[model samples]
Structures are given as C-alpha cells and as structure tokens.
Target: SILKKGGIVPVFEPTKATAATLALELPLPSEDGVWTVLYPASAKAANTLEDGLCSRGFVVRRLNTYDTVPATWDTATLTSAQSTDIVTFASPSAVKVWSSRLGTLTPVACIGETSASAAKRIGFDLVRYPDLPGMDGWVNAILEVIESSSSSSLCKHNFKA
Candidate 1:
C-alpha cells in the first residue's frame, strides 16, 4: 500500500472546498475500494458544485465536520492563544474545522463571504475577508500583518525566528 510505502499519507489542510478538491483529485489518480471523502462547504458550496461533480461521475457526499469558521491566522496563535483579532480560512474545509472547533461567532476573516456563511446556520461571523481569489491574497494579508507588528523582528535570514 502507499501507506506502507510512504508512512502515513497526509492531505493538505485548510482547503476551502475539501469535497471539491477531492472530487477533482480522486479521479485523476487510480483509487480503489469503497472510498469516502469529507467535503465541508457552505450552503452555496453544497448546492452549486454538485452538477459539476456528477458530470465527472463521482458520488460526493457532505459531512458534518462541525467546522464553524475559517481560521483567522495569527502567527502567535500557531503555538499558544485562545483567539485572534482576525483569522483567515483559505479553504472551505478550513472553515469547517474552525467551525467544529470554535463553534462559529469567532469573527473570522476569510477569502470570501460564501465561505463565511457556509457555517452560518452554526452562528459564525466574518470580520474582514478578501475578495481576490486563491492563496496569494491570504499570504499577502499575513505578510502585511507581520510587517506592521513592531515587536515582530522577522527577517529573511531569520524566518524561523
């Protein structure tokens, strides 16, 4: 098995559209057996992306991963912190994980509102999210924050520090 060959196979995290990504990724590679994937999307994600998957001959299912909000990322929180002023959920799956762990209402800053509202029934809220699509915006927001914080002495040479 690939697991035996490579140890535990890890899937990338913080995917906004886990199901979508799986639906796209699964068929590309050869898979076998009764395989299932968890897709955590807002109502819109659940509703809109279905036909596309069906077109590809996949049976995508939605799971209640209990992700309420997309993670608004603060580097400090990478180790210790109960919360943040703003968090970013780059993926819909990230939102689900945040929702499940934090139960929404955490004032998440996300890439878009659709992702924000995915967990709306669970009472999550969006603080300030980006409109530009994909990962570049997410990286920029984090960089902007890193630059603004006076106490953060992050240099190119000392990135880990």
Candidate 2:
C-alpha cells in the first residue's frame, strides 16, 4: 500500500547503522508536503522515521495502529514454559513478557535480530537469532541451539509468537 502511494521505505536492514544512513538518503520534501506514517503503538515514542523525515523538511502525521500487548498465561502454561529447553520468540514484547513471568535461565531463539536484542537486554544469557528474518531462519536458529547443547536428547521447545 505504501509503495502504491509512492512512499519510500528504508532499503537497508533495520539497525542503528541503517537509521543513520537513511537520513542521508531521504529526498527533500516538496513545499508544504506532509508524510503520513502508520506505525505500531508499541514502537518507541522517539520515532526515527518521523524525526528524520521532519528534519528533512517534511511534515509528518504519525498514526498509532495496533499495539503489541503481553498475553496472559495460566500458571500451568508458565510452568510448562519454564520446563522447556529453549524458548522461541517472534517479537520483543514476547521476550519481555516471558522474561517477566518465568524469569528462567533457559536459552532463547528469536525470529529476528530485534527480538534477540531484546532477549539479551532483558538479561537472557544465551540468545540466538538467524541472519535472515523468517520462519525458516527462526527454525534454523532453534536447531542450532538445540544441536550445540550437551544433551543429545530431543529438546522441548516453547514458542511465543
């Protein structure tokens, strides 16, 4: 939808480096032009995209869409999660929620760098994420962690998406 409307997206991977470089690549806004940004409500308040675009002379209209909220888990579910060999997370919110609830030292396998970074920041000792972001990459990361463990037995994995 954004592409059809002629909106530009960052070509580089989403990281601090990309954010810095993206500022240099954005085109100067036309006179009195406004850019509407639809973003997740859970995203950081200091939106880099809106800030960069506004600094480059565009009036940005930011809209908060759906938020990523923590899911409520029953005691039994939480206990099961704690017993797992590894926990897989698809989002930063999930990692934070899991850490808060279980506070276990079990290893984590993330679907992407963002989730992995969150897990590490939340004090998880062992975090793994694949180079690419997708189900295949996520599964590979989980497999890698499982394979490297001293136990050769099948791993009981817990997925939080």
Choose the strongest candidate by lDDT. 2
- Per-model TM-score on C-alpha atoms: 0.36, 0.65
Candidate 1: 10-residue stretch with minimal lDDT: 152-161
What is the lDDT for 155 in model 1?
47
TM-score of 2: 0.65
Candidate 2's C-alpha runs over 4 A off are: 1-37, 40-46, 52-59, 152-161
**CA lDDT, candidate 2, residue 90:** 79
Residue-by-residue lDDT tens digits, candidate 2, 1-161? 34446976645443322333445565554556564444444454347667776677666677776577777788898778766777898777888788888784877888877678789998998788887545777898887777665353333333332
* Candidate 2 lDDT for residue 148: 63
